[model samples]
Target: MKKALPATHTSMMRYAVLSISLIITTGPAVSSALPLMAKNFPNISLAMIDMIATVQQFTIMIFLLISGSIAKKIGIKPTISIGLIITGVAGIFPVFSQSFVAIFISRLLLGVGIGLFNSLAITVIDLLFTGNDKAQMLGNRSAMEQLGVCILNLVVGLLLLINWHMAFLIYALAFPIMIFFWRYVPEPRVNKESKETHQKINMPVVWLALLLFFLVMCSTAIIVQIPNIIVRGSLGSATTASLIISLNTLAGMAMGFLFGRIYKVVSDMTLPIGTFLMAMGAILIGMGGNLYIVSLGTILCGFSYPLAGTYAFNLLSKIAPQGSETLGNSVLLIGCNLGSFISPIGVRILAKISGNAFIGMFIVLLVVTGGILVFQWASKHVSKMKKV
Candidate 1:
């Protein structure tokens, strides 16, 4: 049954479904421990060791495109299970490996595993729920990934005390998540390909993907430049930086839990509101050198991302054709990962142009965020005029 308005899910199955997301975002976070890793692997070059954190992105993008076909052939349940098993096993392989090559391969396999299940995580929500229920769950899904990133990042700090390798053990959480998911979440009925076979994806999905790509790029700029903002601005110490990030993630979690209500109240205005808030944050951090002010800006940026992300995915579920939402999501994720991959270069360009990294980046971010609203307003206005 399509869940009605103001929807909520309280079942054990709900948690089981959300568990996969917790581990999905855990991969990129290994970058946080790179300094410690560099110390431990003295024989390996820093650039090569750094690649361990990113090598998965290529495999992940590859698998994201193909997993839809794989799901169509094998069915979603088995595909999800296979992905989970791969994630759990490959995620921890680094714990046993001292060789950079082996750990790099492990990270590659980890990306492959994540790509297999990444779109399906969103697809499963559409398959199992509907309407506000789906919207709410999508919000929670983003929250789950953010939560994983935050918590596991903290855990990685602690685990490094035990062994440099022990930090990799954090991925073991995926095993239990898989077991519960397999036992509780039933296999959803797969939609047979009919129109989806003949239909090329419509232009709106592509535009949305491009929009997502831009938003992700802007979002990555926020993280990339934060340290420079802290050190250059001399806002505070590393401890202060960590706290600021905590505030950011906590705000995101709160916003995500409340997204359903926000959407119900604002309807289509949700996107503009989110983008505005994000731009506001960028402006604050760019201009506000005060420690507390920067922290507030950080929180606002954090809050806006999941708010915008959930809305985008919810719209995708509506606009994408039946049996093809997964592929549409694939394109979106590709744009998303591509944005992250290229963000540093973008940051460098901004730094060179403005002669200041933090303020210059946010200045451009503010302008780009405004462009999103302009484009949205123009599109809606034209659509209304056509109907009239």
Candidate 2:
């Protein structure tokens, strides 16, 4: 019938899963608090305002290529632990300050911390687990991260209704959990040569990473744009828009719980299925004329996001060289940040030209889905090769 996955698989996986989840929760807390942040710090320009998303991505993109090397030289545990400490401290700094310079410094430090964490976290999953275990581990990892973002965003939104500074406090909440993870999570096993050489970047991996970059760009655009689009487009009131966004979060949390279990049954169908659903969801959100339609689309969008995200990571792990765990994970961070970095500007420019964010987002989603399909084909063909 079926073989069993290892106990270490379940246990060690939790450490990365939990830490990444915390990291996601922290950043989105800022996003959810944007209006309040702007009110408190009025000098925040549209260009500087956009930096809320862009700075983090810019830092992650710049550091991702180097993080793999750092993880190899230092060790994943130390890298991640140090990142958490820095991230926690930087994240907490903004809660007390209204100075734009101080706030910007905090955001910059937060970005660096995330860069470190993102680089090591996914790669550690590749190192700690293998085969079917790897697939499931990645799925579970994606779920935890997605769930954290969705849930924490909701919490931040709720807390923002109370006070903006309260939302920043949420970043501190992660530190205790990370401390526990540091104590419990075992160090990864890397060979001396793998650590020394830093393995050549595979051409196929780079190609696939570019494809993932496009996919994530569309996803981040939707995630950031949906609430405002709904409110401004007259599809719903602010409260209704927030609730719809929260439903999207719930969908992600549900998908995270089910992703690995579903993968066991669907196998290779997962990525294609997820991409298709996600594309359909994005289109639904774009074309939707009312809140009901938008809400339905969001639920579908949520399900599709983490499913595809997890599949992307699983594919990266499969193709990555031995001891290239950090590198593989770095690719994911790079792809995701590249997507985030481009989305707001693209959406803003498109909105300026087209006169509607919905239409712009719709066009972008179609292009993104097309990219994912191309990568899906490439990855399948790559899977067929005896050597990557």
Candidate 3:
């Protein structure tokens, strides 16, 4: 006979799931509104208009470097609450002002808020669950994040039709999530003694983070290059490109939702498997002449992104010392953000060297994938030898 869990426990899980979705709300906050914003601010250069998105990403990177330390000092709950409040408040600033500088400031603040809680989502999940449950929750978190991106983008797109400023209102969703978090999510107890006893980060974890960096960099290249690739090839219009990208997002979300089951089947091999898929995707995109093949490549790349991310974070949680999940997540986030920031540059450099951008990107993906496979095999052999 099995004992049933209490209602309170179930309710808390529901609230936690809802609260975690806020972590991804910022993903499409300004992205969907960019065109309308450009029209509204006709005086600003297109590059500067693009800065409205880039500035937030830069802030997110900077804050990600420090968010773990902030959590340690202030406590995760307080840090998350503050982040939610800042995100909610600052995200709406564009509603009040049309000035480029004012909107930039708002986006920067939103980034700060996002950075504060971005890594913390995994940390909190690590605290609340364990073993298979933890894996399941992490998968669900990834799914919810992708779903949030889809929903917010759709909502913002609709709102942009009314007015760009209306899109900012989506950020206000953070307040309720903050309240849910504060009320339902238990604060993890800190052990002052564990601080002194913390172990150095595992070498394997560092290697995994590096691998993730390359993977993210490669995956992001698809997003950056697809528009130009399609336009230049005469394969599709901008709207078609957008639709393909949305399908890619949807594929990732579907994989995320199925991740728990997938993990059971793939287990530790998830990393290599995901890397292989990403490489294949990149190759398809680079070589495919038709729109269908390119769309398929985008979907595979999208699917692999979340699959790899979920497994990597799960591995990090396993390797991290007691009371150091936050720090581990911070390291992972740094790698992810750095990968994204450098992706465009990396592509351009490779394109220049190879004389063909698509081919260059394909080479990069193939090399990275080969490296990851070798690393995985070596690590497994080493482990087996240690057991002997």
Highest lDDT, which number? Answer: 1
TM-scores, all models, native as reference: 0.91, 0.83, 0.91
lDDT for residue 309 in candidate 3, whole number 0-100: 84
lDDT of 3: 0.78
Can you write out model 2's per-residue Cα lDDT over 1-388, one digit (the tens) per residue? 6776554555544664455655653565567577767787676686575566346656656667776666666777888877777778887786787677777778877877778777666677667777776676666666677666665776777877878777876677558757776766778877777767656658767866775776677676777777777888888788887777777767876787677788889887777677778767866777767888778878888788778777777777667776565676677667777766687776778679767665665666566667656876886889889475
In model 1, where is the ten-residue run with the lowest total lDDT? Answer: 2-11
**Any residue pairs clashing in model 1, and if so which?**
none
Candidate 2 — which pairs collide?
123-325
Each prediction's RMSD to truth: 3.2, 4.2, 2.5
For candidate 1, lDDT tens digit of each residue in 1-388? Answer: 9665321244777878888899886777777678888998899898987887788888999999988888877888788889988988998998888887888888899999999999889888878888787888888888888888888998988998887788888888878988988887877765566324733467878877876776677677777667667777788887678678778878888888889889888878788788778877877887767988888888898899878878988999778865688898888889889888888886678669987555665666567667777887898999999999
lDDT of 3 at 254: 89
Query: Which ranges of candidate 1 are over 4 A from the true structure?
Result: 1-10, 194-200, 352-388
**In angstroms, how far off is 111's CA in candidate 2?**
1.1
